[model samples]
Target: MVENALGDANSVFSSKRAALRVLVNHGEKDGLTAARMILTGIPLDETYLQNRLSIPMNDEKKSLKGGRIHIPDSYYLMGTADPTGILKSDEVCIILSFWYMHQ
Candidate 1:
């Protein structure tokens, strides 16, 4: 019984770990999370590598007084405090997008 329990636990752990790995590598976004980021002053930089914006807190240590999104494709950076910074506007509002296509 003990051995069987251990095996089951291991199996569950492995699956969870695998899922995490995929999420980390590919990047996953939720609308709510993205909205929070925007509200917190973190702009969305979608034009990242592999259409995936994995912003691992560029300025993690710093409490975000304000943040900007650097969209490499348009070469325009958007700041929440300063909406005028955006050269092009996206249809989605404050989208925390995981997948960004690179042309």
Candidate 2:
């Protein structure tokens, strides 16, 4: 009975470890994809994007702030705030998304 219990526990641990490995790898891929979309999908120039954006905090930190764009008389674009700088417009909203390694 003891041997069987030990074997079962080991098997469960191995399975869980495999599942976690898969999740970590998927998170890395997702982070890269989000980073790409943010860089190319936005209308902003490459240089501007680099200066305005911060690097991923970790492999799981990949995110895209605004995928939706609004067009109008004045035009609305996605932007983040810099505490030390000024915002050209009076209207500013903040949004955040957290990417998890698992699910």
Task: Please tell me which predicted candidate would have the highest lDDT against the true structure.
Answer: 2
Candidate 1 Cα errors over 4 Å, as ranges: 1-14, 30-103
At residue 39, give the lDDT of candidate 2: 37
* Global fold similarity of model 1 (TM-score): 0.17
How well does candidate 1 score on lDDT at residue 58?
A: 25
Each prediction's TM-score versus the true structure: 0.17, 0.16
lDDT of 1 by residue, 27-58 (tens): 33642343344446543343332122223222
Best by TM-score: 1
User: lDDT for each of the candidates?
Assistant: 0.33, 0.36
- Cα error, residue 99 of model 2, in Å, equals 26
